[model samples]
Target chain A: MGTALKEKQEKDLQHEDLLHRYRNFSARRVLFIILGVLILFVLAAFSLTLGPADVTIAEAVNTLLGMPPSGTVDRIIWNIRVPRVLTAIVAGAGLAVTGAAMQSILRNPLGSPYTLGISQSAAFGAAFAVIILGAGTTQSTASDAVIFNNPYIISISAFIFSLITTGIILLFVRYKNASPATMLLTGVALGSLFTAGYTAMQYFASDVQLASIVFWTFGDVARASLWPEVVIMTLAVLLAFAYFFYKSWDYEVMDSGDESAKSLGVDVNRLRLHGMLLSSLVTALIISFVGIIGFVGLVVPHIVRRIIGGNERYLIPSSCIVGAILLLASDTVARTIISPIVLPVGILTSFLGAPLFIFLVIKGRDFW
Target chain B: MKLEIAGMDFAYDRKLVLKNVNLKVKEGEFLTIIGPNASGKTTLLKCINNILKPKKGTIKVDGNDINHIGMDGVARKIGYVPQMSNRAFPTTVFDTVLMGRRPHGNWKPSDSDYRLVSEYMEKLDLQDIALREIGELSGGQRQKVMIARALVQEPDILLLDEPTSSLDLKHQLEVMEMVDKQTENGLTVVMTMHDLNLALRFSEKIIMLRQGKIFAYGGAEVLDPVNIEKVFGVKVSMAHGSCGPVIVPESCVI
Candidate 1:
């Protein structure tokens, strides 16, 4: 009877432990997502006020909501600042989430939409359109968000060509069941191959075309101010993000390695295929609008993983938030730092991201 | 559950690894596979777990072909702990073990699974470092974590490939003894190991493989010095120790 009493008490303690663990796990992740969403919104609101025209944050918010901000503030807020900032948030969020998925599927920390040369190939296609086929030039710009002069044709070509790179990579992965190193090497090799083709095309381009091509490759988020393109990017990113959430649990297990995941009954090849397809789709969507925005996809996920340990459930959403904040804040600085000069958003990300990436490698040397 | 393998064949790059391997494992039996480097022990285990599909054969669990069953169903019945886990990321020990519950269709780890996993973690003495990174743990600790993970699956059959390869002698005996105790409840145990003495002491049955075929299969009587020398090209003697027949490897012939 004494033993029976002890067993019953032990059962009660075990039950309590289970409930406590579940509560602790879920509460932390929920708080993280809530905080991320909050930060992204605040960053988006403030970024809208940062430009040569000098609209204050409150004025920008008021103008956004159809209130009074004096004359033509609504037009500038509606036409210019709102779309640009929104695009930056969308692009940044998309790239980072895709980065998280890429890293998991490839089992490599450095995996990203850009790492697999999707962005480089997209740059080649967009450059091809600008230089060879005679596209947009920034010589006659009144408003600074002005790189997307030939929007329709350029966007389509970039989207199509990015998918082409994704297809090649997928085909390669299917054949050898490629390792992470192989994927990285193949991607880098593919990038060089496309770079060679793009360089040859540049030689035939005239001086005006060459200037436009240079602007496009530097990742101008300004190009996305065309409302229809912004609408497409925003809609697509959100939808793809939803899909990633559904696949997050599978990704968490896959991080252990393919054999372990298979032992756990996960169809590893299918999961990787889904991850690659969705990530590339998100990459194609963003790269089409903004030319090769490097490092956000590669960098933001690493930072998020370091902060909160690598559970894909929290990792995916937190990465999106951190990425959105990073891009929106950087794009704002890029616009206002030199006043009317307006450095490309891509240039700003590399300047910030490269040094930070190097520091992380040095500090957390054996992170993987 | 009863496991039967009939005419199982496997090849990698046109070189056959396992050929016509036939075996039957009854419920609650401890079976240890002993073989040299190129023998088909690992391939046979992989076939049973459905990691690699044999060229032509059937692995039936209680008379149902493993191919007919979904991989999840196969995973539900058999918990596999492979040799030398290549884990790079530092996930928590609890998270590592909790993945075993994934195949059982419980998304949040049902109360029972949590209870069972906790029990196994405690039994394995892994509760102290349950929240620590798997990568941070010593090899013996990680091996225990792997055992806890496999145990948490609550599988009818537990398949291990060199489960004690990294463990020291003390932990090795502890794990094998624990597995031995669990088999009293009709849990099927199949594992491959290099230590024939442990197999002689702990396992109910042993299967010896040479090249791509089963050379011998039976009780400890099959591990005679002649058979050991023929299979492994090593000279060894079996002595009647206090525990059981202990295999003493004298020297390698090759």
Candidate 2:
């Protein structure tokens, strides 16, 4: 009778333990999600407040809320600063989420937009548009002369090339049964090849064309107008995010290796191809608009993994929000740190992202 | 469900791995295949799950040719576990097990799926470490988690390739015992094992392979001392123990 009572008590304890765990897990996830959304709002507000013509946080809020604004502040807040800030936030979130998805799919921490040669290929394509297509030159007259002044054409070219590069890499890796190390090496080689082509274009470019190419590569959110480019990029990012979120479970399974995922009823090849395409599409859209922002893709996913573990359900969304905040903060610093002279946000990201990545590496060395 | 393979011939490029192999597994039977290294044990297991298509011959599960069924449909009927454990990403134990329900439902796990996963975790005594990262677990714990994941699939057929290769002796017996118990539930289990004695002790039937062809297929009675010596190229003596007959390799006397 004593043994039966002991067993009953143990069963009750186990039941309570499970209940506690389920409640705690759900609660913690909810808390993080709320925190993430709140951080995005705060960062958005901060971004709106910074720029060449500084508006006070209060005025910016009133302008955003469609209240009466004082003097030139309305134009500065509405026309220029708002679009730039929104561009930074959207592009940052999209790129970081893409990076996270890529890393999870490839099962490599180093996998990213730039590391996988997608961004570099896009940059090369843009450079090709500028040089070969003469899109950078300002034309004055002559009906027969080709005019490549539109940024959309260049962006489309970049997107196409980036997709092609990713497809080629996937085909080669699948055929060769290449190890992750070899995949990374191949990506690096492809990146270098594209970079070389871009450099050659730069060498042949005129002074004005060179300046334009350099600025594009340095990444500027300022070029984002309220045009079709913004609309298209926004739509593309949203679609990519939706697709990735839907496949988050598959991505999580994939991190366990291909064989395991296959046995668990995941079509490993289809999952991988879909993930790569989504990631490449997101990366291409961001790079086309903002040019080559280097380290956000490499660093943000690692940070998100450390914070919430590598479950894609949490990782994808968390990385998106944290990435938006980090880039917004970096952009704000870039604009305000030197007052009138704004440094490129990409440069600032590298300066900040590198140290943060190193810190995470040191802290999470045991897990790695 | 019964699995039948008829005149199966498979090869990588021109080098044949399995040639004209025929086998049948009844429902609720524990079948183990034992062979020397490079005897195509892993390859045969891969073919059963349609991971590698047989160059010649057909495989059927429950009278339906596997090729006629879609890959996902075939996967739903069979659960496979490979020999190696190399998870590059640090996913948690619960999520790993939850993945087995992939073929059963949509992308998001339903409540029933979670319940099934929890049941398996508890059965495997893995509830304590369900929240932990898979990488942090010991070899035995990791193997248990993999087995738990496969169990969550609720597959009619479970195929394992050297499932106990990395496990310690105790964990090996623990795993085999679990597999043995599952047989009573009318689930067919096919496994490739490296340990001859364990295979003999636990499996209801054993298939011995040499050069990708079946050398022998029968109960422990057919696995005589002469046959063991011939297949493994090692001298062994059989003794009747308390539980059953034990094959002790002569080299172990030292």
Candidate 3:
């Protein structure tokens, strides 16, 4: 009876120990989440305050909250800064989340929108839309002249091609039993091919058209308008994020390989296909609006993975938040660093992202 | 539940891996398929689990044909544990085991699923490492965790491919012993083992394969020195031990 009681007491202690560990883990994740959300909010406000025409923080806040503000302050904050900042947040989050999902699905750390050639494909499509479709005088001078002039259509075209290229790559990988290295090489080849095509189109383009394409590809949040393109991209990204969150566990299991996932009753092929498709969709949506921003998708997921373990539940959401903050910070730097002439958000991100990625690689030499 | 594979033939491209392989595993039987490398042991196992679609065959679980049932249904009834543990991401033992409940689970794991996982983990002596990352564990512990994951499926039939290949002697014995215990509890086990002695000791019946064909299929008593030498092309002697016959290679003798 004494031994039985001792055993029961030991069991209770073990149970308590498990509970404590679980609570601690959950607390850490929740704290990070809260911290991430708070940081994003702070960054958003900072973004609103930091432009060429500096509106006071109070006026910016008032304009944001839709109060009756001074016309100049209202116009500067509402018309100029708000949309750009929101674009950065949305595009950053979307690209990062998409990258996280792609990396997990492909089981390749190097997997991302740009790494998989999705961005390049989008660029090709955008180039086609601008150089080929927009070049026709009839369409260029029509009532929808502004539509042809807008970069959004080109972005959408690029997005569709990116999705197509991604689909083709997946099919090839599946059919040929290609290694991850092979898939990476294939993506690079496709990306380079599309880039070549885009360059040729640029060579033939009018000065204004070439400049527009260049600006679009280089990425400028300042060019982002509070238009239907922004709204659609935002909705698509949010929906994708929600769907990924719902299926995060399935995505985690899928990283274990097809046979293992299948034995565990996950439709491995379907899961992978769905994940890739959704990721590409989100990538296309964002790249369509903001052109191709690099590194956030590539680096954000890796950073989140290091902090929280590779459970997609934590990884996806954290990546979204981190991506948003990183882009906002980078965009701020781009605005301030050169003063009057703003550096492309893409260039700034790559500049910051590449160095940080190299640091991470150096630090995480032993990490899998 | 009984598993029946009738006239199963499998091929990769045009090269046949299995030809007219008919196998019937009775309920609660511990069946081990022993074969040399490239003898189709793994292929046969894959066909049984429906991972590789057999060119010409029908697999039936209990009374229902697998073709009629969905892959998910087949998976619910059959659990597979591969030879190696290749995890791209660092998954915890608890989460890995919880994945076995995927077929029965919604998006989120339920209370009963957690309970079942815990029970299986406890049974496999994996409770200590339940929260630990799978990559941190040793080969044997990872294997046990894999087994626990399979168990959480509540499968009637467990299929293991070279389950003990990477394990040390102690772990190999421990894992096989667990398999032995599982059989007594009415869990049907089908496995492929490279070690003949381990197969002799643990399996209720052994099915020996050579070049995609069954060389012999019977009790351990029939797997004598002459047969072992003939099948494996190695000289060996079988001596009666306390519990069973012990196979000793000729090189072991002074």
Q: Give all candidate RMSDs, comma-separated.
A: 2.5, 4.1, 4.1
Per-residue error for A24 in candidate 3, Å, reads 2.4
Candidate 1 residue lDDT tens string, A154-239: 77777888888888888877887877677778888887787887788778777767766666778888877778988998888888
Task: Flag clash pairs in model 3.
Answer: A122-A158
lDDT of 3 by residue, A1-368 (tens): 99999987886566556545655776787788789999999888877888667677777788888883688888887677877788888888988898888887778888987777888888888878877777311223221122235455676677688877787778876687655556677888888988899899889998767755665677666555575656777898898899889988788878777788877667776776677778887887778667778888988988776666677778878989988888888888988897766677888987887777678767742347
TM-score of chain A of each: 0.89, 0.88, 0.88
Better of 2 and 3 by lDDT: 2
Best by TM-score: 1
True contacts kept of each: 0.36, 0.51, 0.50
Encode model 2's per-residue lDDT on A94-210: one tens digit a residue. Answer: 888898887876678889977788878988988888877767666533321223387777777787778778877787667876555666677788888999998998898987677
Identify the superior model by DockQ, candidate 2 or candidate 3.
Answer: 2
The reply for model 2, stretches above 4 Å from the true place, is: A1-16, A70-74, A137-150, A170-185, A225-227, A364-366, B251-254
Best-performing candidate as measured by DockQ: 2
Where does model 1 exceed 4 Å of error?
A7-26, A54-56, A62-71, A137-148, A354-366, B106-112
**Candidate 2 local Cα displacement, residue B252, angstroms:** 13
TM per candidate: 0.94, 0.92, 0.90
What is the DockQ for all candidates, taken in turn? Answer: 0.52, 0.56, 0.54
User: Over the stretch B1-254, how does candidate 2's per-residue lDDT look in tens digits?
Assistant: 49999999999999999989999999999999988899899999989998888999999999999888886688789998778868776777888888888878777889788777877887899889978888899988988888888888999899988988888889999999998999999989999998888888988989888889988988877678877766778778898888798888885222
Preferred candidate (TM-score higher): 1 or 2: 1
Candidate 2 collision pairs: none
